[model samples]
Target chain A: MSVDQFLQYLISGITQGSIYALVALGFTIIYAVTRVINFAQGEFVMLGGMLSFLLISSFGIPLIPSLILAVLFTAIIGAIIYLLAIRTAKKASVVSLIIITIGVSIFIRGFTREFLGVDSVRPPFFTGDESLTIFGALIRPQALWIIGTTIVVTIILHLFLSRTMMGNALKASAISTRAAAMVGIDSRVMALTAFVIAAVIGSIGGAVMAPLVLTSYNVGVMLGLKGFVSASIGGFKSPIISVIGGITIGVIESLAVGINWGPFTSSYKDAIAIVALLIILLIRSGRLALEERAD
Target chain B: MFGFVKNKWIYFLVGALLAVMVLIPFDWFMGKYNTLLIFIGLNTMVTVGLCLLMGYTGQVSLGQAAYYGIGAYISAILSKTYGVNPWLAMLIAAIVTGAFAYGIGYLIFRLKGNYLAMATLGLGLIIWILFRQLSEITGGPDGMGGIPYLSIGGFGFYTTFKRYYLVWFFCLALLLISQNIVRSRTGRALRAIHGSEDAAESIGINVAQFKVKIFALSAVFASIAGSLFVHHLRFVSPQPFGFLASVKLVVMAVIGGLASIWGAIFGAATTNILSDELLLGFGELDTIVYGLILMLVMIFMPQGLFVKLKEIIVQWRSKTTQKV
Candidate 1:
């Protein structure tokens, strides 16, 4: 392939990758704090997108305010979910928590269908009708927004987690709940904060990506599953690693579709992210076992 | 006296109820729609297997529908292409699905919790995709048709009423087997593992073996149900065995009460029938309604409807004794 084609694909990959990264960050934050993988995290993204579409298209709200409203609404919803469904199952087993989260996800998905209707909704792009041509490849203005937003969000998150006391307390709780509690950090509040942050980021992802891929009630399942896969590929260790994993998977997937491996190409594209995740996990576990044996 | 009446008479009443169910086809009032109950019976078979895995073994499989699809496709292809009898095709499907489950269980059951769930979810998605994409062989999205109806003693059971009895027979047989397994020593091992895997391992239980075995057993049941479903419907599609179907099965098992055999049947019937009714009348909102039910059940009735019923019964009995 030409360098220009490859660059175009890379740019497209990075745009999709930014969305995945945001969702993955949401998953990681929730997992880090609560030690519970919120299965409904993807639904928050769907809600954001659908709500943005409704606010912008239906209500004629400005794009920026609609996006902000979508993010805020999703954050509140995440906190409400934790308070209502997850709190009761706090002492329950991880299996129960997983089931409850799945239930919550389904409930949200169902509620979205009821609220938004079954049709895919698209919001007007914030960047307007502008396309930039570089090396004979056209790039949408919103693609730049996605990439720019991802970097800005990452920096803000780093600052929030490091420079702020509540952020440090959240990190401390993630590390050791007992120790954090001893230090007078309320782990419950920290968890809620993580949920709020994650939801906001996830909503931002949904709002940005909604124009690229139309927003529907069922979109969360696929996005959430992919985000989870990205987190897993990064070993769920660091947010930076999670973003890298998301971008890597996204680029590879885009390339697979671009290359067009005959009839199997479309099928292979869907399977690629999952296959990469499986291989990474297998290799990681193998290395862990070897290290254990050496020890 | 109440305990004796409840325990002893309930069994007889259940038997009579089942017998009446079986005899419904002979009566003139039964119609073609009564055959839907056979599908319910097949669902019960699969759900019972799922209940054992999820409830007793404490392992969640989102790939039960994969096994079901495998059985359906295998049996359908075998009977259609090779001209194998439906009965023999079903048997082969069960064995193939069981063996496939064994291989997958070894690889996947190694991971616990959400990891296992995700892995199995991937597996199910792969199968569903394969069924859709391999259009040349599996007929793609249009699905395969002309599947032969099951036969016994020179009688072709193709009608809905006839298939109802056939499916009901298999359901009862499977239920009996499931109940027996649940009451056996192996059941105890599974429960122990479910309660706490680390504790079960400490007590000398072969945790891996029990898990793989139950998983395989569940696959067998699901495969058999799939085979029967294909035979009855005479058409097989990927949509019915997709990831959503697997999720629906899990939801049924949970809503009906996991680990209870009768609860599995009740759950399958209730959720399936309710969904069908809601969807037929209410359009897309049915999914939302179903989701609401699932969330409400998990939040308020984590132990499930069966457990709740048992609690109420116990309370009623105590109240009656106080009056006495």
Candidate 2:
């Protein structure tokens, strides 16, 4: 409500939003290329966080090296998910594809449960746990890392997609696999690249958020759904739009908590975002239908 | 023979089914299986409705468990708190759920494919949140209890054996009704819609109305199942009726062959047994196993277990005849 409070919520919202954006970016890349909404995307995020925690806490590995390995491991798992599950169901219907991704998600979650146990884990912060006060609003250092990395990743992704040959090929395949194939672009290769990139980004999201929110086996579903909401709200048109959507969702959710209506506390946090998901989806699909009709 | 049954062979089949239905509850050996049978029966009601929606109408709903939860909560609240008769509560739950589903279906059916699925998934999660958050009404995470049993003419279906019969009788009636619908002109129209919505519209089929109707019908089935479930368990909980339950329901519908009414029974029964008996000791391994089953079935045999098994049996029969 007050400026300081507003700033505090804004900082927190943006921090959370960055994580969602990363996950949504994962969703966006895969959706663009393969037209499959990979439900296992969140599992990659979870694996990133949990793996980093395991490496750092238990193995006593340095933070930076552990983070790098965790990200790489998650990316590998992402590719494996694609190779094992998504690629195999190439000719399946949309419903089948959704189920397959969900299956992979469940498997990953189960595997994580077995490997990591059901308890939550936290990776050490990239920087020391110092809270920086910017204009009377305290921002956790990990929050800055989350926000900073998201921006950097978005900029890099934009440059890569626009500036590189491989990126263009991936984009081309996404726009139309048939045309891309005709032009000698390997759609399969593009798809595989998309999965790898998405996984990498999702892992980054997981690694950054682990310090803030404690990574656990079950967090994948909630995180994945949040990312999904962001992607849908973003209209899957651009990564920028998804980032905005994620921030909007975070801000709204934070403000909702700030308001503190009866039964609208932290417990109903997921519900608020889901309501936003439905509304945005309704509006987007309605407009999309209109666009189709006009065309 | 009645027009619905059509032939003497049909009458004989019906007579045999009736005999088995009667003998099951009365047999001493069947006593332990009664509760499991009751659960399967309840799942069948929900799965059958899901079959009509997903298989016949080609609309995906990942929120059937939410409807089921609504039904249970409604029955529990009305019968327990308001002191309404449980049967009347069940009927009310069905009507209210049908209306709710109809409203949501109309709004959401516009989105096709993955969007529809995601929307339904979100809806299920929201309802789940409500089930957990609305503690005053739903009893929060601990869930509501003391739900009364369904009865007829002052005879309470209190015992597990009695509940088993009551639930199965409802399930069988539902199956018969579903079969009748599938054979009717409405079924044909639904099939047409599934084949192609644009084509169905061109043929003067009210695709939207039919979809909404079927969605409502499926929700009603889930509602009835929820009512029966609450009464049987004499408890209502938010824990069981979550996204996983909805996914399991979809799994049943898919495994049973989506369009086959009888397949719903097989799918529900098999899934229940797998979760209760085989997978229970393994804990969350059930989720992974279910996921594997869903993927494997979708990949190798999209036609579903019933249809594929039937084909295999037919092929084996021909081989046996050749050997003879």
Candidate 3:
């Protein structure tokens, strides 16, 4: 492909990647604190999109206030799930906790379907009817919004974790819960905080991407799995790596689709993410083994 | 002596229940819709296998449907493309599916917990994508049709009643085999692994070998069910074995009470029938209902319907004894 065509694909991929990064950040935040993979993280995104759709279309709210309200609403729901399901299964086995989260995901999916009705709803774009042409590649103004918002969120998160006492406590709990507790940190509160932060970021992601993907009840599963895969690919170790991983996946997928390899390429786009996940995971495992042997 | 009587009586009761189920189509419920019940019976076969792998072995698989799809496609291709006998084609499908499962299990068994789940999920999705993309072989998204009906004893089983009987027989056979497996030494090993893999390993259980065996066994069951479904419907489509369908299979195992062999059948039948009834009326909201049921069941009754039933029965017996 030409430079312009490649740039066009790259820009679009970055836009999609930002959303995945936001979602992956949510997964990372929750996992870091609770040691539980919050499978319902993706549903929070769906809730954000669906709520935004409702606020803008039905209630005639402005985009900024609607976005705020949606994010807050999703955060509350995430906190409630943490309280009801995750807390009750705290002492249970890891498998039990995983099942509980899976259960929570299903419950949210069902509730959304019932509340939103059967049809898909679209949220109004952050930017109104504006497209930017850069180096012979056209980019939507909303794409910039997605990318910008992701960067802002990442910076804010970095500050929150580094500069704030509560953030440090949360990180302390993640690193060593017993040590954090001995130092007077409330691990429970930290977990709840992580859930809230994750939920808000996920909701923001959902609101931003709704215009591009449309808001549907069942969108959570694919989004959640992709986000989880992104987190894993980045070693689930650092937020910066997570964002890079998400964007890389999005760009590769978009280019794969753009190139049009064969007859079933379009349908296999979703499968590409899964295959990438498997390859990355196996490679990571192999590397871990090699390092162990070296030691 | 009482224990012996109870064991024999349990077998007798199970046999009687199967006999009654087999005779249901021949009775007044011979409607075309009873054929749907037969399909449910086929699903129960696959679900039982899933319960064994997921429930007893404590290994989550999202690729049960892949095996099911493989079996259906294999049977369809064999029967349609090569003019193979239907019975032989199904047998071949089961074996091929088992072999494929062994290969996949070898790779996936290395990962544990969420990683394993994701890996299986990816495998299912890959198979589904292949099924959709490979039009020349799988007929693409539209699905492969024109599969000939299965027959035995020089008589074609074209009618719903005959097909019902055919599927019922297989289901019964599978149930017996699954029950035997679950009550055997291998079953104990699986349960041990589920309880504590480290402990199971220290105690001389070859954890990987047990996992691989159960996975292959589960795949075989799923494959047989798929073969039955294709032979009955005379069509095989990728949609029936997608990621969503695999999730539904897992849901069935969980909802039905995973530890029991019969739970799979019960879960599959209830969910499948409920989905059919609700989806016809409520449109896409049926998915919501499915999700809600799964969530509620896991939250409130993680032990599942079978365990709940057992609890109730125990309570009832205690109350009766106290009254006496």
Candidate 4:
């Protein structure tokens, strides 16, 4: 591909990568605190986008307030999910937990389809839809908005974790739930906080990217999978690394489609992340096995 | 007579079960539900394998539908396009799916728990994508049809009655074989690994090899079911082999009491009845119900519905005898 085309793909990749980064961040926080992968993490994103649209169009609320309400509502749902489903399961095996989260995902998808309908919807862009020339490549203003929001969120999350007593308690619980509890930190509360934080980040991503990518009930399946891939890229440990992983995945995918050589067409675009997931999993299986054994 | 019955009641129960199995599909019997029974049989074949993997071996596979799709597509393509005997095509599908599972199992068995689930899930999605994208070979989303029925000599499994018997035959055989496996030395090793992988490894169980072998065996069962499904329906489609179908299979395995081989039959039958019969009018509400069933069952009785019910029955029986 030419330099301009490369730059164009790069810009678009970064924009999409920011969304994946937000989703990965969500996964990381939840996995860290609760040791559950939270397969329904992507549904929070879907909820954000779909709820924002409902608030704006059905309730006749303005865009900014609708987005905020959507995020808050999604956060509440996340808390309920933890209390109702995840926490209720006493001494659940890993297999049981996985199936439960999958059930949550399926339930959310079906609920949305029944109530909101299956058709894809896109909220109006934050600014203008017009593309601006940057280094001989075109970039949409919305793309910039997404990337800027990601940076701000990351910085604030970093500060929250480092500076706040609640955040430190969350971090301590992630390190060792038993130890955290011994230190008088409520591990259950930490898990709830983790879910809420994950929801906030996922919803922010969903609301921000809704205009760029159409929002729908079933969109969570793919987005969740991709976010999982991104988080797995960082061993689902560090938020910073997962953010970088998300961007790398986005760039590779964009370039794959942009090049359009052989089986790299858009038809096989979804396969790219999954294939990456398998490859990375195979490569890291030994280390991951050790980690599991350590646990 | 009562003393004789107590000594030989097991045989009597087995004889009665065999009779019921044989008589159920007759015209005067429950022939109207023959189609549903056949589907339950097909699903039981797959779920039994899943039971062996999850219940016995303590491994989770969320990509069984990939094997199912592979078996169906291979049988469909070979029998229809190449004019191969349907029986031979089915055998080939089983072998190929077995090898594919072996290869994937070798790579993925290293990861434990949730990561393994994710890897298998990714594999299923990739295979589903292939089924959709390779339109020329697999007929893509429109699906391929006109596959021939399985035949022996001149007789063919063309009618629903014939298909039901054929499917149940395969299903029962697999269930029996699975039961034997559970009773054998290999079953002990699998249970040992499930109980504690490290302890199993220390006991010279060769954990990885056993896991890979069981995973391949499960995949083979799923493939055989797929072959049967394609021939029975005379069609192959990518839609049925997606991620949701894989989840459905796990749901069946869980509901049937993952550790109990016979429970596979009940799991498959109950799920099919719920979805295909009772929930037909509810549309998307069925999905919500499925989700609820999975969550509630896992939370309350991870040992599974069938196993818990059996436990409760046994407890009640003991209580009644003591009162007597």
Over A1-295, each residue of candidate 4 has an lDDT whose tens digit, in order, gives 8999999999998998888899999999999999998989889999999999888878889999999999999999999989999999847989899989999988888898889888899888989799999999989888999999999999999999989999899899989999999989998899999999999999999999998888999889788888999999899899899999999888888889998988898899889988888888888888998887777
Q: What is the lDDT of residue B139 in candidate 1?
A: 93
State the lDDT at A240 in candidate 4. 99
Which candidate's DockQ is highest? 4
Clashing pairs in 4: none
lDDT per residue as tens, model 3, B1-324: 867977998999979986778667865654556766887888889889988887887888867899999999999999998999989999999999999999888877777666777788778878988898888888999998899999887899998888888888898799889989889998888899998787999999999889988899999999999999999899988998986788788778877887878877788787877778546666555555656666556667777876788789979987997999
Report the lDDT of model 1 for residue A227: 87
In model 3, what are the clashing residue pairs, if there are any?
none
Could you give candidate 2's per-residue lDDT for residues B1-324 as a string of tens digits?
Answer: 345645776789879978887778765757777888889999999999999888888778888899999999999999998999999999999999999999998888888777888889889999999998888888999987787777888899989888888899899999988998889999999999988888999999999899989999999999999998899888888988887788899889888987889999999999999988787888787777778888788778877888788789879977997999
The prediction achieving the highest lDDT against the true structure is 4
If both were scored by TM-score, which would come out higher, candidate 2 or candidate 3? Answer: 2
lDDT of 4: 0.91
Q: What is the TM-score of each candidate against the true structure?
A: 0.94, 0.95, 0.93, 0.97
* Model 4 alpha-carbon drift over 4 Å, by segment: B1-7
* lDDT by candidate, in order shown: 0.83, 0.87, 0.83, 0.91
Docking class of 4: high
Which lDDT tens digits does candidate 3 get at residues A1-295? 7899989988988898888888899988888788787878889889989999999899999988999999999999989988877776677555556666776787788777777875787787787857989989999988888899899999999999899998899889888788999999988899899999999999999999998768798888888878888898865668888888888888887777777767326677788788888888787866533432332
Error of 4 at A134 (Å): 1.2
Compare candidates 1 and 2 on DockQ and give the better one: 2
